[model samples]
Target chain A: MDKIENNKAWFLVLPVFVIVAISAIIPLMTVVNYAFQDIFSPQDRYWVGTEWFESVLADDDLHGALIRQFVFSFVILLIEIPLGIALALAMPARGWRASLALVLMALPLLIPWNVVGTIWQVFARADIGLGGWLVNALGIPYNYTSDPVAAWLTIVVMDVWHWTPLVVLLCYAGLRAIPDAYYQAAAIDGATPWKVFRHIELPKMRGVLLIAVLLRFMDSFMIYTEPFVVTGGGPGNATTFLSIHLTKIAIGQMDLGPAAAISIIYFLIILTLSFVFYNVMTRMGTGERA
Target chain B: MSLQLQGIARTVGGSIHLHPVDALLEPGLHVLLGPTGAGKTSLMRLMAGLDAPSAGRILQDGQDVTGVPVRQRSVAFVYQQFINYPSLSVFENIASPLRLKGQERGAIERRVREVASLLHIDHLLDRLPAELSGGQQQRTAIARALAKDARLLLLDEPLVNLDYKLREELRTELRALFERRGAVVIYSTTEPIEALTMGGSVLVMHEGRVLQAGPTAQVYHHPASEAVAEVFSDPPMNLVNVEVTGGTARFPQGLELPLTGHLGMLEDGAYRFGIRALHLALRPKPGLPFLPARVELADISGSETFVHVHAEGLDWVVQEEGVHEHGLGEPVTVYLDPTRLYAFGPDGRVRAAPARGRGG
Candidate 1:
């Protein structure tokens, strides 16, 4: 077969490049510009170089927020991934029940993030909320507004309730994609149910689990609106994640240059972590299949 | 161990997949020969306890195990598609069954190596299933099944997915392997040559029913019904409708063939005369009846040749050894021994007769 050398294909890709530049690249460049310059007015901008970056990096508050952010993401992932896989395994394999379960699992994901925060905020109040009232009725001292532990627990539980469904849905799809022949062969081999899941289902779900991990990691690392609406980073900054801190720097105190620098650093952190995750996961998945 | 299926029937969604079937399978290689949608896989699955039968019971060594799940039964099945634990190496895949039974690691390794060597895949034990070819993957699956040491082994068209040359090689290897395993192995296939080469008891099935079951040679030489004969022959048994009158059967072309023995016992009426392609000689010999046919198509496959002839408004396939060229539309005379022919009564049942000498 003769190859068709067509330079005209370059013209087809030009529109996509232009759209990306207008939608993403241009805005990112503006942030990059803001990170390096101090602007007192529209025309009174002065170059600051790495001064704001150094300050943001040295700030103890920023360090604390970054640690808190890491802890939250790590804790949630440890809980959510296993819980989701177990839920997916327990779900119905077929029929109307499967359809209904899928819809119910997807309900939390469909709700707006801020709406989830608002709902939890009202639902966790000690005087009127069911959860808070029940806890108090059970003779436990639980007040999220005053106790740091209670606030952290409430935020983690709220995040789990709102996001664990995503992991469950992805794992469920992975489970369903496995062919029935594998299970049949395993059964005939006298494999126990745990052995079946460990050898067959877990290996087959590796690719989807990787995706779920990456998605949940990046999303949880950048979480803002829910915590911001619920606790507003209160209880002596116990739940003040990096995103909330960045927002407070950029809008609450109007420190644009340091906020821009922190934003760039946060983006780099996520990018580096995601790249590491993707490389490790793809290697593992391909290595097993290979 | 002896495995018996007692009046087993399988129905899915209110439609019958396999009607009630009862058969006693002894310890040896038994071939289940059938065409597609013949319920061969379903029957195998039921026997392996992978699926419960809608009716009847399964007995193993005179013990009822119909209610037992597949994992509790000492049975192993190899599917048409080569199924392996994709994440595991060939060694691990074979060792998995023993591991599931909580066997020690040393014993598991020994059994895995033994089965791998038997299947000639010991060198590929470290490789994953995806890295292996179709034939290698199936061999690995077979090795895994063998390592399990199940008393009853079920293989549903295990070689159907392999290439022609690989299929032939594996068929020979599998026949020997089954003999050494000392298990009651039930192998299903749609190919007649495979059933013949395996050389054991044969169960001929069609449309969810068992038409015939007996020794492989007995079924081949004497199919119980026209349906069984059709499924038992490669180009399908050449069945010609004949009218019998005065102890003689006459073809449509007015050729009167002498009816002897059991064929002569039938009252004068319409009957079906069946003959295998190999029994029809292209050349006429002494004491053999000849039929006039016109060559319609000649299909030469490797060393064997199949000549399709239109004889008296009926198409007949004649199998010939080696290559023999015959021009299309050429008039030819094919020889067939009357004693070797099978006669089917009006009800489609084979008319049983005393065994005759095997002829070329």
Candidate 2:
């Protein structure tokens, strides 16, 4: 076992290690530098210490964006995970229907993220798109560009359409992995379809669902493209999410020191939660099957 | 009610259709034996009502059950894959049937424990299937089925994954258990000994067709054809690879085996012969024919000897339990009952056609 550790088999990972460190570490140092020191120009700088960090933390704009991010993550998890699972269930397990459903789902995910934003941007405009025209035709006085609730709903709907397929794909794989014998046993047990889903399908998918939840949470929290394109944080900052707000402060305001501080805190929030999710999922597997 | 399949056929994957089959079964422990791709599992599936027949109908107690859903079939199947809920504890797996019917908690617990005890998996009730050994998981799966209280039991090679010794012991116990309960069992297996030991009527299948169906003893003693004879033992009942010509069957290596007995299917001339190694008695038993031979080789099983013989210009093999005095190269005249000869025609069918009608 000791010799197994010393096998310098790490030679295989040496190149990967170097690449990751170069890409991740170098940018991280730059962020750290801007976080503590004021960079007014290319050649002039002064240390602002925690002044910018405190100001950014105290700003009501930051508070509002943070709340929106949290709510968006929560709402997406609520809607997408279950809806995706339902879609996965209704999908045929094999044959033409299965492949067709897979291809249809895959089409959405294959579109680039920015393209997704542009598509939704045009699709939700009342003067131009079918969806906007339908809502107006229904006379609900809906305007995603001008109304906060409409903007939030539009963003959530766009995210679901774009990402629910990922959850469906994962859950579909989990469902397929279950051996037919289990269903045979369930049939013998007199389980209705509902009981089988609750007692078997639900538990079997818990592990994958956790992963899906964490991924969707992270993606939804850091959402910057679609909402940004649709509203551009517009109608007086009603649709402004945290990442979009951060970009405005960091790039639009050109205040690197405060933006850097805000970004570090933002990174920490994601890092902490993602770590917790990963730790919990891995530990659960260890306590059970292994 | 006994499970019955009369002229049932099913096609798998839309392209592969099995031959139409008929099976009249009794309420006893029946073991369906065959080789790979023999449609044994498909037969069990039909019996369990998990599948519908494409050609003919199934009748249970004179009731057409061809369209009965699996849940209403009153038949329990223990699948070969041991597919219990991996996330549920052993007790939950066993109690699922009771729980599904809204059985009182106390009664569910008692029944689950009883079935668990019967299958010898009571101690592992708290553990999930993934936490148990292959054998233990298999027992939980069996226990779950037992607790279901179905009228007919269909086992699709349920113990195939078990170690050899455990399989033998469990099979023996299961046979007795099913018999004592008077529960009809339709079991499918790829092993001949399992069918014989279970001691039900045997249905020998080959390539989606039942080659022979009868009592275990009858099928073993007089298999309908070389194809049926192949299901009798492992590595199959070996053929001498000789052909009947004139009055004698000749082998390439300077041996002429006389046409010891006649079969109707052989066209007055050429054919092949087969015999189960176990059925070839070493010592003469009253009316049994003894073939003169030498011990060419011995399969040294710890408790039994399987002797290979070169006899009368033909090489044949026999199994002798608790082999006491057999030595390789020792000249021995092993017995073969003339009445027990299994002859096959050139077209690979039982040489003897049904003399009158079907014989029981």
Name the top TM-score candidate: 1
Candidate 1 colliding pairs: none
Among all windows of ten consecutive residues in candidate 1 chain A, which has the lowest summed lDDT?
A281-290
Error of 2 at B210 (Å): 1.9
TM-score of each: 0.87, 0.85
Q: For model 1, what is the error of residue B110's alpha carbon versus the real structure, in angstroms, after optimal superposition?
A: 2.8
Which candidate tops lDDT? 1
> Which stretches in model 1 have alpha-carbon errors above 4 Å?
A1-9, A39-46, B54-57, B102-105, B247-266, B277-341, B352-360
Chain B TM-scores across candidates: 0.95, 0.80
- Which digits, one per residue and each the tens of the lDDT, describe model 2 over residues A1-290? 35455667789899998998899988998898999998877689998888888899999999999988888888999999999899989999999989999999989999998899899888888888888888999998788888888887888899999999999998998899888877776776678899889877877777778789889989988999888888888778887888999999989998888889889999999999889977777556323441
Per residue, candidate 1 scores C-alpha lDDT tens digits across B1-360 of 999999999999998999999999999999999999999999998998888999999999999999998888888889899999988889999998898899998999899998999999999988988889999999999999999899999999999999999999999999999988678999999999999999889999999999889999888887888999899889998889998899888897778887786566877888888888888888868988888889999999999999999887468999999999989999988887676688888888987533655642
Write down the TM-score for model 2.
Answer: 0.85
Q: Over 4 Å off in model 2, which ranges?
A: A1-14, A39-51, A279-290, B12-16, B241-249, B258-268, B277-341, B347-360
